[model samples]
Target: MSENYYELLKVSPRATVAEIVTAYHAARNAFSPDSIAVYSLFSAEDAQTELKKLEEAYFTLSNIDRRREYDRRLQQGTVPSAPASAPATAPSAPLAPVVRLVPTPAAPAAAPSPQPLPSTQPFPAPAFFPQPPYSVTPTAFPAAPSTPPMPPEGVTGAWMAQARERQGMTIEDVAQLTKIPARTIAAIETENLSTLPARVYLQGFLRNLARQYHMDATATIQTYLARIDSLKKGAA
Candidate 1:
């Protein structure tokens, strides 16, 4: 039977070319960034082999003729054939088995002895190692872990706080840098949403703060978005 390429790529057989490319990129990203020699989740050698498989799958699935031929061969329980230009070779001959027969040396016979048959009594019970004394006491299992509470809807404050700390800048220093008031910076860090300007301006302010702090601006935005979403869902 043909190998299941869909399963190898972790995608449905009916997946579009774009979906296959997306899956491949996602797999590539999942690997450790420090290890650049390899691709996907394998050794460099194995990754090369895997990449070949991926390419083959993409190629076969992307072309209707190739896909149909592959499917036809798979259904017929036959491997897909090469082109007419391919050479035909003789069938392989069976290999001969290696055998070594050694004659046993005769032993010197001395005496014949009579032996008594064992009794069919039950076998003695095996002795087990002494174990520590213990008693079963039922105890309630711990409660399932709870998900962390999402950050507040206006987390631009937290972003501002983290950014300033990373930059080794105090609120006064940030005030000098941005010419904004120290109180505004303090309000941003403390997440006093009411003290900040319009909601639209909040994103820009947080983005600038993130750049100054060398923090991930995208992640900061996502956190704020998640918080806002939770609040909208009444989950905040």
Candidate 2:
């Protein structure tokens, strides 16, 4: 029930960046407007407020310098408090009593007798003229066969992009399906490893993307790690 960012995300103070990211996603989904789990429990405004808090927590704790500063603040017992609000269970004043008005009774009127209604005779159907029979002919057009998506050709970002395209998936589509950010997905597809998270988190992203596209997750992860190693060696 603590309002601390770590508590809000259900993570420990020493949680890794990958853990923080995972917790952030879980928290976001739990409070999402479209989430059925919280549909009845929280109003749209409340959900949005909680989502904002989750984002703030993630943004702070996911950054190395910010997280270190926050930890220092926590250790010094100087963490900022949330804004104050009205008491939860304040009692309201009782309503004033209402007075009812009485009315005088009126005299009843005599009932009138009902009259019978006139009945109309039904009309007979007319004889139909001769008509031609209509029939629907079934056309037998052959169904076009669907081709399976091709496997990735190599362990490079280009192959990853090609595989994604072959599966007819856009970066946004993959992001939505995988719950990974579109920017992260773009970085992966473009081989911009420097812009991505640590190796563990990057591997997780690759695995999730590969699973979504029906590719071999193990192979994709191994290839991506190998590529990263080569890049590091070249830079060194």
- Measured by lDDT, the strongest candidate is 2
- What alpha-carbon RMSD in Å does predicted model 2 have with respect to the real structure? 24.3
Which tens-of-lDDT digit does each residue in 109-173 have in candidate 2?
A: 32133222223222221121121121111111122122223335446777777766654457775
Cα error of candidate 2 at position 205, Å: 8.7
Among these predictions, the greatest TM-score belongs to 2
Q: Give the TM-score of candidate 2.
A: 0.40
- Quote each prediction's TM-score: 0.30, 0.40
| lDDT of candidate 1 over 31-109, digit per residue (tens) | 4344564545466655554555555554554344555654554444343222111123322442233122253253224
Candidate 1 lDDT for residue 75: 46
Model 2 segments more than 4 A misplaced: 83-236
TM-score for candidate 1, residues paired by index = 0.30
